[model samples]
Target: MATESAAPSPFEDQVLAHLRNAEAAYHAEQRERARELDELEATRAALAESQTHARLLTAELDAQRWNAERERQRVECLKQAMREIHGALFHGDVYTLILRACLTISGATRGIYVTCTRPDGPLRVRAHIDIPAIQGAAPPPMVAQLCRDVLAKNDTIVCSEADTAARLSGDEPQGLRFRNCVAAPVVLLANLDGVVLAADKMDGEFDDRDIEALLSVGDQATVAVRNRHLERELQTAYVHTVTMLADAVEAKDPYTHGHCEMASRYARLVASRLGLSEHDQALVCYSALLHDVGKIGVSDGVLNKPGPLLPEEVELMRAHVRVGYDLLNHVPALRDVADVVLRHHEHYDGGGYPDGMRGEDIPMPARIVSVADAYCAMITRRSYKDAYPEAAARAELRRCAGTQFDPVVVDAFLAILDTPEALDGDSDDFAECGLLPGFEAMRAQASPV
Candidate 1:
């Protein structure tokens, strides 16, 4: 029984060994598959991290690009404003340009330029732009007060919706419904010339960026204002110099004591009555004043001769027109009127001296000055003649209309003389028709008197 049992167990033992080996091989395959899966997962995780980092870098780069673009736009806008401001300065339109530049730079729907005529005077609108709904409306009291504050502090005021509400919510009257407002002073040499205001931003509430842009525009406006101020000063100086020269000429002859002034006033009146352009009016006025300036080249004997002039003295007197033309033609500012001055004594019939330009061939300004000179001379006593009565002067002007004067100018002047305004002694001061368009107030402000 023992020998048979031992012989039969060999097959069973071999089968058991095979089964154990198969189980070990299956475990080894499972371990290899698990390790491969872990390695694949680690690669996937690393790829995901790289993608996230790339996305973050892209977002940062986009943000930087946006910031750079915004800065570029800001700089471009400021540069454009500066260019416009300089153009305005060169052209003498600072008030209008300030409002336009502020509206452009700040993206405002409404803008106002206010200036105080005097240091203590109330603010007056120099220029303004508004939406249709608020057209022709006066500036809100609060807004005006804000402008005053800018003048007072010599600083800028920026008001958001909340800030505007807080400021206007109190006892102050509020007619404005704007969501934003910006105001800056037009300063020059530490003196406040005026305040520039912008309101109702078209895009959004005004922020520090808008404020800073407005400040740059204000700085440009300051330069323009200073330039305008300098130009005004220079113009005043030129006017004074010309007036003194005229005065000196008149002083040399007692008979001509107010002749230049009378001629200028008459010329201005004639120009207005003729509906001449302001530039032409100015030309006529200045030409009449300086018509006799060439007399400075004449000898005292020739200029002050109480009796009729001999042919030689008359030739010398006639030389004054050419002399004045030569003298003023070289001056840049007076060049435009030099021809007018030279031809002021010319006759309408081509019988006059110098160029003998006739009718329309004569410059309109010169013709106007000619009429004025004749009128002034007829009414005022000269070295060779006594003053004529108004009626006699009018008759003389009418008699010489087609010969020594332009008939149209004579008629216009005669009509002006008939007006009640011409009878008023102070009418010259009230007559602003000779002022350039939109420059009457500016000229008045610059008047030294």
Candidate 2:
């Protein structure tokens, strides 16, 4: 047994050596794999960090772009406001011009021009888009009150989404109806007259950007309102001057007094019934009152001819429309009205005057005035024609519908006349119906003779 054991010692030693080598190789491979795993983990960590940094840089860039766009919008809004202020201060009919500008700039679905009755009285909506729901209808009480409050405080009130929701939850009336609003006091120095409130943003609530935009607009509006007030005062004085000039023109012809005055009153009435916008109604009133202004250019002999004129005289009489238009074109205040005056004689059938425009091609304001002028001429006393009774006037208006006058305008005029009170013997009948101011009184003041 001892001899057999001694013979296998070398073999055993060799096997032990091989076993140690295999274990060493296994341990070396394990260490290499561990090193590779550590390297992979480091790579993964670096990759994650790079992605995070990239995401951060991308977010920063997007933020900068958003801020730049917002700044550009603010700058553009400021420029527009400056332009509007310039227009308001320089232009005639600044009130109407400003209203139109506000509508365009604010993106309002509708806007109303309002004036306070007194320093502290409630705001009365004067002009709007001419929707039947708004015309002559009382504004919501809270809106009136809010306007008063803003005027009193001289502070701008911006109703954002949260504020709107909160206000709606309260007893306040108007804010609940409007989804969003921005109101700024229309103050001139220390005098607080009223506030221009823009309501109902089509997108959502009024944000800071919207409030800033409105404030910019308010700055322009303040200037416009002050300018308009001054203009109205000046125009009132000019109206007196024009009245005298018109009276002198009428002095050469007695029958012209009732014709011009009654026609003006009737024109205003028809304008109201036809749903002409407040701006158009004012323009029509001005144009109708001055419709015979062209007659001022006519010689006394032709103007007071008292009977049928010669062909040349009739031709000269027909030139008055253009003459009136030209005269008013020089006066910036009456430029828009002058256009109506020039087209007042245009017929619905395209047979009537300077341009001979037909159907809807004729300006609606002119179409309204045409019916009013004809109706007043038919109803009022004339030198060569007997004044027709109201019934005869109605019949004549119906006869000329869609031919000499727009059928729709004729219908509106007839509807206004259908109320017997509107056609009563009193010359102020239309005024009593609240469609216009006192016709007889204005006629008395404005008549040439």
Candidate 3:
């Protein structure tokens, strides 16, 4: 009966079913835990890879920043050097200044400036710095020859070693020593003018970096040198043009050869005696030279008249000053000259021609030129009359000083005439007319008026 009852207990059967269900739930929970563990492992691997990628990105960013910074520094240095070069060029001889600047910029052990005599000729040293006393006194012939070759070819040469051994192997001069050298031609357009040589890099042997720096310096030097050369040429040309213009005006009057320039010199001398500033002296000189340029517009008969001018002719002659002023007033380079030309005939005591400018109303340059021109005319032999003696000319200037001539300018002229050299008329003529040679020829081919 107990065995039968054990098979038939509902509550016990329920308990067994509950235990089996619990075991199944436990197995399911264990499976879920294993899946969660696998997911966690995968997440850790992804995080590690992401961190590595972030590190790599940060390293790449740092490298880019470093490169950018270096480039900025290099550009700034080049700009500074260029500015210095520009300043030096304006202040002094361009070649000398550039040579000094290059030495300072590159910090080379030594530097040399060599210019060729001709396009293909040998090179001669113009300037140099930082060498043995003996070497400086006499540069090696091989170095000079090499400079010529480089300039002729318009090529650059960089040598890492400049010792006697290296030089001897190549047939260069002996007893020479240099660790590095760079040579470049001063080329403008396709023509080579000279060469620049730098030796012994202070930091290390010549490399691309060193070469690039030298090249930059060389380029600036070349430009500055060329500009200075051009400026000198322009100054020469300007002087020539001024002389020619004066001559052309003088040629209109048969009795007035070289008179304009002579009068200008006299005017400058007078102004100098007055303790005038250099600028004012120059103005006086320029004005005197151009005082009669308006006569170019006058008729030949009137300009070269051998007799007294008629009242009408005198009026026509007076118009020339205004005409000259008009002709030159619009030109920026000649405005000052035009102003003096207009007022030079004005009287100092309020009675004058054109605008009737009086006293200080007339420019100082005009006043000064008026006194010089009158003095020169008094002492100069004319077709109408012989020249006056020094005493008579001095008396005439003094007589007209307060009325016709500027008082200060007349005083200066008197002082200039007091010198022993002004006693002889011929001496006065020479003093007034001595101009730089070839002035006319130079003027004929000048660029413009």
Using lDDT, give the best candidate's number. 1
Off by more than 4 A, model 2: 1-225, 418-449
lDDT of 3 by residue, 1-449 (tens): 35544464899889999999999999999999999999998999999999999999999999789656745665665676666555543234456565665555455668777766465665566677664223223346656655756765777787766342455445443324567777777654445667777777677656565556656666666566665566556545655656666677878886777566567767777777777765566667777777887887899888778888999999988988988888666544466678888999999987888887789888888898888788778778776688899799889999998898887888777777667544433423322433322222333344244
**lDDT of model number 1:** 0.74
TM-score of every candidate: 0.69, 0.49, 0.59
Measured by TM-score, how close is model 2 to the native structure?
A: 0.49
Alpha-carbon deviation at 429 in model 2, angstroms: 13
lDDT preference between candidates 1 and 2, better one: 1
Question: Order of all candidates by lDDT, from best down to worst?
Answer: 1, 3, 2
Query: If both were scored by TM-score, which would come out higher, candidate 1 or candidate 3?
Result: 1
Runs in model 3 deviating more than 4 A are 1-97, 107-119, 122-184, 197-211, 221-241, 270-282, 330-332, 416-449
Residue-pair clashes per prediction, in order, are 0, 1, 0
Where is model 1 more than 4 Å wrong at Cα? 1-83, 114-145, 148-155, 160-179, 185-194, 221-223, 273-275, 420-449
lDDT of 2: 0.67
Ranking by TM-score: 1, 3, 2
